[model samples]
Target: MSGEEGAVATETPLAALGETMDLMTALQLVLKKSLAHGGLARGLHEGAKVIEKHAAQLCVLAEDCDQPDYVKLVKGLCADHNVNLLTVPSAKTLGEWAGLCKIDSEGKARKVVGCSCVVVKDFGEETEGLHVVQQHIKSH
Candidate 1:
């Protein structure tokens, strides 16, 4: 994928943006693992609600989220709750990895353009992958 809006490719677009590519790859891996561990919350509303209740352990805000306020809310909530926040360069990619993929009636993959988060209720095996994500967030 070229990381351009409206691109139909489903491949990870990690080759064109130097350090950003690295960040995207690392986040993508974490999202995949988090999904497998059933610790993900997909979409802006869901993420915000989770954060509002102080349930999220780590949050991934796509850099291209459709709603700017979504980003602000997530950031402030994360700060207030001491949850880690990381940014993925593309919302589409983040959505796909977080199991939010959908196909339109026209048979095209719909873009995931909102915020996604990892909600952990307790510190257990489900949060094992969060350590890697936290390391990446600190470096960025």
Candidate 2:
């Protein structure tokens, strides 16, 4: 029994350019624990919806072949919507998110480079980032 190879190979590319990896990674911890404590299917479904709402492109990285069945559902949505999804640098979701966040120089917001996968077009260095985040959230 091995982990899903495909899932472990893809790292969140946004992680390198932004700050939301921390939030994403932390959610993995909560989700995994929830699953272990009897919250896998229902809880994961709810969380996945929230993440999907927030994330413009949802990347579902697999830890191994034994990846949870629930994640498969999320991946199906991603496929249907044509959202860019990747699976690599895998771990229990949160572990991987933390891993990516550590590398994100801009992984913060609210004067801290907040972590959301939204960006302003044609904006320069003088842009108000929080506003950008708000707009990004609104657009989706």
Candidate 3:
């Protein structure tokens, strides 16, 4: 192949991969902030409950989640309440990041629910990560 065609072919997939990695990195940051601070509520039920009370600042949903009704309900509530919505790549990954797993007494892992809502009530002095995630979502 010609040098131009070879360069195009090589760069196309890498560019797509880069975008995917960037989103994953951003998702991790959001998750970390949500967990470390007192602003996180994990799982579809918890998130929806917070949204129902108009207490959510932002909502993140895993794009690969199997629960369509969960996504639909959260999306509708977010739109109605003017909360920001974000999509990650996988529910499992998001669950791990949100610490939605527990090690049983038998040393086996149990998966908890997925999805999360970031509450803004206790934002306090740590707003950097929040702004970064908000900006990232807006740009995307």
Maximum-lDDT candidate: 3
Whose TM-score is greatest here?
3
lDDT by candidate, in order shown? 0.64, 0.39, 0.67
How well does candidate 1 score on lDDT at residue 87?
A: 73
Worst 10 residues of 2 by lDDT: 113-122
RMSD of each: 8.7, 16.1, 11.6
- Give candidate 1's error at residue 26 in angstroms: 2.7
Name the runs in model 1 displaced over 4 angstroms.
1-21, 102-131
Ranking by TM-score: 3, 1, 2
Q: Count backbone clashes in candidate 2.
A: 22
**Per-model TM against the reference:** 0.61, 0.31, 0.64
Candidates ranked by lDDT: 3, 1, 2
Evaluate model 3: give its lDDT: 0.67
